[model samples]
Target: MAQNGTAESGATEERPALPLPRPVTVQEIRHTKVSERSTGARLCSCSSSVSSVRLQLCSFYKFGIKCQFRQKSKARTNTWCSPQMFIDNEWRTSSRGRTFPTFNPATGVKICDVQEADKEDVDQAVAAARAAQQRGSPWRGMDSSSRGRLLHRLADLLERDRLLLATLETLDTGKPFLQSFFVDLEGSIKTLRYYAGWADKIHGKSMPIDESFMCITKHEPVGVCGAIIPWNFPLLMFMWKIAPALSCGNTVVIKPAEQTPLTALHVGSLIKEAEFPPGVVNIVPGFGSTAGAAIASHKDIDKVAFTGSTEVGQLITEAAAKSNLKRVTLELGGKNPCIVFADCDLQMAVEEIQKGAFYNQGQCCTAASRVFVEETIYEEFVHRSIENAKKIVIGDPLDPQTSHGPQIDRQQFDKIMDLIESGKKEGARLEYGGRAVGEKSLFIQPTIFSSVKDHMRIASEEIFGPVQCIFSFKSQKEAIERANNSQYGLVSAVFTASMDRALSVSAALETGTVWINCYNALHTQTPFGGYKMSGNGRELGEYALAEYSEVKTVTIKLSETI
Candidate 1:
């Protein structure tokens, strides 16, 4: 459990208020100079007894980083964090000297200005990665054990700075702070450590041919990989790409999603501190059109790994084909389904399904947007699901008691609302919650719609919000058919007690991954990806290593050698 009153199991809890900021006037506090950084930046710090709210500002001639500071009475909390791009193993601004601001989705306030990478910046990063991949370069020459040492060191640093990293992620992405810390950050640490252990363990194969010739296969690092990560799980997506690539001894240029780049930039600092050779890993913060496109189409990049929307995944794939024919792997969007049989534990199914549909504000690609229930228990399941949805706490992500936060920004908020409106127009019964919470933040009501038809937009389209659509199915065959009707094949879930049914349905589903009695369960040891329009390529486990490696076979004749 965290000292901030968070539960070990990541349940919401009540806690005392320490430093929630009150609406203030200018007279409340004035800025006081703290010190100057070597970068010619002045640090301004202020405090006030009028309220717990404080302000800290770092201003340079050409750059500035501003942050809001609050306190947990004795413990400190940072509201805004400094953001920078990591390239050539150094913190830098863009070549064009342009920056874009990112906001706290929970508060709808701009938190910090992030450096925006354009074409030139992407080119520089790609060139650096290519250089690092060259023979005799530090990263290329390093042994697998040495590479693993750096990754483990980086993991240790991440654990040491876990609180700060989680805070930054919560502030930037509007996910619950505890969830960010325990789930995203914890997953990242475990993933890095897991890949680190596999560094020296990656092996090739040997074969003897007809006793006269010897043949061997070697798995070498794929040169210069480009990874474009998504906003939903910024830090975790980052690790998902770089961890396996580095473990396979590949150099990388990563583009963190522009909306949530802070935590990735923070990890950038750790990468430098861990002393990874320059260009081994570079973090570029920019929009998908510019930085992301450059990565996907860059001729020098040998491989590209991306996690984003299905539309963008197609663009990346096309860009790869139009360029140097780079190897590509993508983990795209999902419109997942969760089928509940009458034999399921009623209470357990309701609770687990709620988490699947509402966790991370339902921004997860694998969220159970479409839930089909056995017709016999349809009424009970709907009522119980509504009850569970009502219990979900929605507020500021920093609050320990808040289980749900705002959507990423205005665009996503509008999209979710539009989908909700369409559901009503299409005649789905709104059981509860179908409006925006307030005018202030980007919060939506945890919505549930019953009597949904399989053909409705709310049922077929990926509504990446805290909205659940319930449909009734008469038989197991009907449930499977309805679930597989979508264009996506990312994931699906089944809540049933019968072992025979679990296996039968799980095998019949058209998804890349299936949960027999659970939902939203992800592990570092398991392979994860999508099928069909969902995406291409797997992300985790030993299978992921293949995406970042190239195999070459060599044959030798004993007589010829002599």
Candidate 2:
């Protein structure tokens, strides 16, 4: 064994060296407004069982560092590195020194303990963000071009660490690594770069007024944004909220969902490396009741953005209203419907519909949960859908061949199973899988419920699992009506070759977005959100900028100017 770096002071003796430098734990981070304060207790330890030997201190040496050991399997492995909340600029624990274990849903293995942000931690993060937003602050004083440059640099860093980020995401969320790498990570990078370009382009407009006066309107950042992201697409959601908010010069206190915080914490390191000003971006991981509610209701927070269930979205809205009437942008639940007409290509519809409903294990908010097929092809669609469900590989997310992994956690898995049971009891035919595949983890079989009526719980409610509900209808008007029967209006799709029918159905569906012959087609250029209870405000495209901005009109009296 060879030493890789210089030894730290107080090393009594040199011993076998580690093949790689031990990674620094979050507890070692210290800087900025959230000041480092520990409870002076070693909450956890990472050590090997074998006879330990001290090695030279590596470049990554810090407090709470893990011990690396060689295994009998001829592989080097490190103990789990505990995650810490990133507030202001440093990584710290909750004020009470509390933490909760985050597990890999795929294996039901405790990956590491994540620092839980209590109200006190949330307050500190909010205060730091508020300070960053104050007048004359470095973040607020920076020029738009400079801001854009920083965002671009962050994007570059993200591109460089794409694989690592994807791996972390897969480990935390049970999403396929390929999907995390190709879709979520790529989307995050694109979102960062897209908003980076918009930083300098954020503009004001001049308007002609009366002869005596000149009028102009400018889009300014809403200060100290509190953003809460969902666990489904952890990194992607973080980028969606932060990119536009930071581009518009708003500081942010972000709360990544408790279930999936690894990738977000990893991104915090990149934020530090990007040289973002102190307190500009803070990442806090905790439950919705504590950190999330604190962010929404904090008096100093200017806005609150959430992406989650509609039930939680309502709570956030109420919290904002009770506080400062902070602006709220919510992208919530969906019971999205896909209408497959007889004129459409059968195989294409089958493939895309499967992707729509089962992508990410159907945890997507815009998943085409309900499918209304023309009666002529209803049987064929159901058969194909059942076959497709069977083909979905259920295994470790690390395997690229595994198309489906476990649900986010046990709670979600149980909820999905309950819903499948209800579908069966309600007289819907369970054409395919309807239960958990294995007891080891949270894996649920890809399920299909045919003859599902509009009123059934499985059809109306968002299972948010690998469950698809199929219904048959006669006419285009009937299909549209049936599709719009839900409170959710996030996204819907239509599979038809008829130009007129596609146009009419797309227009008729009460959804934020209607895709024709496609599903889950998202781009930074297109705006995405829900129309009704699904959520409020848009996410992608230029429309997202509005959620983070405030418009102020200024009028100048030409003759009255002193």
Candidate 3:
């Protein structure tokens, strides 16, 4: 194998040869902050003369040197603030006395330790949520308008601290900071406000009954809810579940993924600052087996909403059924297909495919992982995708210039490599980027494999990494067949000039969401979920609010005089 660059002595032999940047200093970052913002925010400015030059140097150094520099420099430490778990109106720790380390994926270093809740902790949280659902609980008795107002207040808090939240999310989840700021944070705020407006407006219709009777229906909270969030877009997923649930008067126990728990914990503080009653929202950060399983099977939980892998979703579903058959809503794995036709704008399609496959390091469930290109454009598309993939900057998430960062952790990084190996072994041609990047950080190159068959694991399974598998099809029927071959069907995209073709292909596709001429476009007002093994139920918009609520029917007899 040819090396792109040379590695320093003592660095891991498997480390990428790309130049590493120098260690960043807290003072330097503070200085950059002061210069960027005209405001006198009392930032401790670094003495470094050039920011880009320092970044380049930091990028080339070995992991050991980087760690040593971080220890010596204040700028490299974990300075972002995070809140503790709130339970029963009090901030507390796990009853079983356990904790888990939360790492910054940008550098694969522990930023802090979050309290790991055990079964006892899950029971306590459930009890607290159940109590909050009772008649006298602040959330239960509050008028709908008041609930809306509280939600709006939370939105305001989030808006005011948007920068803080975005930084923490990027640092923890390895997503680009700017992307998190504009897409994730802004989207979350808008989602909350949108649902807040519905707090007082959720109403059911009355139906005509027999001559002597009247029938009416109402929607009520499902009571206590258990929400299990995945690592990818942690804060945003939390908002997707919590906003509508709280808006509909449902108290919730949120279990954030073990990999990225800081932002969720911080949101707990925001909830308190918004003046929401303590038991109305609780966050428990722990391992999937301990906290997530307990939440899924808890008898007191009236409903369970989860976002994760299909395998995990299945386990949660079975557990929920075994335990009182609690209402379940799951948004699971997606092997979404992006179909490109000969007549489509090849440049636009290439860009969309690049973003769809590699955005957030391909951790998004709805990411376009499979590509079915008409035979005429297959070669060109594969070539262009490889060219674009090579240009993507892969390094520190904190760097605004970095387009792609590391994966969530070492395990995820290894899993992606294993799958890439599988693709190569299965006879798929490795077009580009089938290797890991930086030695210390869990960074994988944005990879692409062409000549992939429909049955290849890379094409059929969810790699959930920055890997794209390309296959060629001779006709639209073949494309549809290939797209629907996967058991998972969450979202898919089609790029074609023919409106009729787009419509026909979209209709034939089995995914719940089909985007034409675009990929990964989402809105808070639109309902999102998947069909088949992609899990059940819907989220976002008014539809998500319904998931947290139940229907109650009432009947009245007309007066005999009538």
Q: How close is every model to the real structure, measured as TM-score?
A: 0.87, 0.87, 0.86
TM-score, predicted candidate 2 vs. hidden true structure: 0.87
Go through the candidates in order and give each one's C-alpha lDDT.
0.83, 0.83, 0.81
Stretches > 4 Å off in candidate 2: 1-81, 560-562
Candidate 1 ranges with C-alpha deviation above 4 Å: 1-82, 560-562
lDDT string, candidate 1, 215-325, tens digits:
999999999999999899999999999999999999999999889987787677667667788888888999999999999999999999999889999999999999999
lDDT of candidate 1?
Answer: 0.83
Supply the global lDDT for candidate 2: 0.83
Model 3 lDDT per residue over 200-314, tens place: 9999889997889889999999999999999999999999999999889999999998888767776775676566875888888888998899998998999999999999999
- How close to the true structure is residue 516 of candidate 2, measured as C-alpha lDDT? 92
lDDT of 2 by residue, 448-547 (tens): 8898887889988889999988899998888888889889999999998998989988999999999999888999878999999998899989999999
In model 2, which range of ten residues has the least summed lDDT? 52-61
